[model samples]
Target chain A: MTEDQIIAYVDGELGPIEALRFERAMEADAALAAAVGRHRALRDRVASHFAPIAAEPVPARLAAMVDPSSNVVAFPARPRRWFDAGGRYAAIAATLVAGLVLGQVLPRGPAAPIGERNGAIMAQGGLAAALDRDLAAAPENGAYRIGVSFVSRDRRYCRTFSGNAGAGLGCHGPEGWALVRFVAGSGSEEQGAYRQAGSASADVLEAAQAMMAGDPLDADAERRARDSGWRLR
Target chain B: MSSHRVAWDETGEIIRFILKAVDGTELRTSDVTEFERALLDLLPRLRRFARALALDAADADDLCQIALERALKAEAQWEKGSRLDSWMYRIMRNCWIDEVRARKRRSETFVAEEEGLAVGEADDRRIEARVELGHVDRAMAALPPEQREVIALILVEGLAYREAAELLDLPMGTITSRLVRGRQALLEMLGEAA
Candidate 1:
């Protein structure tokens, strides 16, 4: 087969008749078969390497840009009055107030001594040790439970965790584990409860999805990340 | 079938509204609301494509942002019956090309960073296989941008030759040639790494 025919066949670009003819020729010729196999393998390898990006959560900033409520203010201030006139702005305002109130009223479990350094959340004491050494595959059944670990779109090592304090996603950088977003009163009451509960709340899940650049690291990848001190470099 | 027709009609109405808005005519709030909702649904796919086209995660997201902004501004240019996703992809490709040209004008240096694929010194075969995939990611980064875009669209994003050609606004022969060259270059890179 010519080079174009080989590429066309590998890409499934050939019509039915042509593909059948190519297949018959491959059966009769070893070199042709080898060429086709190589191209197929190359395509599969490329696909496997990049396919994880599809399962990643869309970033929050991009989502906000497309959301009508947010984009109304983004356009021109004058146009937003239309939304306000329709009462939609009022409803949105009410929701925001309710959210803020709930945020203050929610009972977050015993607070961990987590601090901030260069804008990243720095874990101290138990939280620090857990983030530094804990593996998701082998849960400690302790104060914190590690969920999915992934590489963020910014190439940072990020993981989802839940504890008495709250549930959220955090990324490890030079300073420490930066808490990207945390939702209070959403974490499992206990390790056993978390397993039974299946997953974190929708809000926490959405936060995790927004930061994930690709698929959650598999068991081996997670172990490797932990072993390397959760460093992306 | 009837639901499909309904969706098509709704899309048609939205397009008309978009055209009117583009021409500085008054638009209904509902029209803008409907368009935003549809665009929101396409975010995940657009992000995936952006990730494939860009060199790193941050750059990928920046491209997505630019593409979304352009798509919003040029809403009226989108043909009613054409695939919105494909149209968005084209906008993204053009935006990337423009950035590339601008970077070239500035004489920015491109550096090939070491692949951060190192794992603990374990002899386990599974760990080794995963590391190999990491190498593939790095190898993909080393490809030239034009060839890389072909691999991204056809192999990574699973767009067909015809669809990718249409999206890139290139002829079928050019698409096929780039795909062939990209596959060869990638295989060679992987072989060298091994």
Candidate 2:
């Protein structure tokens, strides 16, 4: 069998019985075997050339994309108008109220809570005090990173914290830094390092920004705030 | 639609799962379908496309989020036996194109190159292979949008030639020709033995 015969055989473009006959012929043909092998190798080379993508670690944010239910919330079908704006805001307020209800009413495990805690510092109690009194006392290190302390555009005092429990942002609002998000591996739960929070991780940073009051608190401001007893407004 | 009834509860559960992750909403019974199950199952592939298209992992995930939001919003339109994968692929392609176009407008100097898109997780041999793959990616990117669409449908996606041709609204010869040219270029860049 020739190279063309093998290529045609592999493509299954040949008739079924003819394909079977070719397969049988290849049993006795060493040269055909080598040729077929090369053909398969080439096909795989092409496929793998594009297929490594499947093996790469799929970023979590992408994985979080599941089809959102239409029932969740509906935005204006058309651009907002003066008349529509009021209706839209009303609808949004209603949705927020509903979300708030669900968030509050839902029973939660220690690991996963449904809604943001208001004026609550819900860290493991002993852990919280240790961080406030001890970890906060340490100087910043590039290696032992404590993310960032920023004053969000919204006047919330936000900070990224990492230690044994993992890295997450805590901010001062009606509820104080109720662990807005705990990013896995962002920090070891060792409760002792100071790492800078990445300005990436939009959801975490956005929460930080949403709670922020103005420009970020500089290192000097952070030190003074810590010195002045780290009060929450 | 019989399968709709056959797995009504299961379908509802899957819808709930997706909804819980996306937004805290409850899906009505009428909103479930086997087509959705098929679409949700393809999330990994969609993420792969996102990573391939976006420069940074963060942006890739954002693209995936947007794509998911779009797919869910348009879920009601998907009919059974209509090739859900292809429909989802079209959605992903459109999302990526829109995002790239927006980014392009924002930054005149930006170019979306495959080399920068790699996650840098592999070894030297794999890295070399990935660079070769990057060339194929560029060659595919260089084709006319129409031809590139055909290659993605028929070749990378493994769709039947006729099905792909139909999906792209092109003649069968056009798909074959585009595929041939695409494959030939890829082989040349990677070497025949590769």
Please tell me which predicted candidate would have the highest TM-score against the true structure. 1
Error of 2 at B188 (Å): 1.0
Residue-level lDDT of model 1, residues B30-133, one tens digit each, is: 33355665776677777777877664567789999999999889988887767787888889888987875665443323322422322111112222444533
Tens digits of lDDT, candidate 1, A24-132: 9999999999888877888887777667766565666786666533323222212232334434222222222222223222222345435544434456567767777
Evaluate model 2 with DockQ and give the value. Answer: 0.11
Model 2 chain A, poorest ten-residue lDDT window? A73-82
Question: Which residue pairs in model 1 clash with each other?
Answer: none
lDDT of 2 at B156: 51
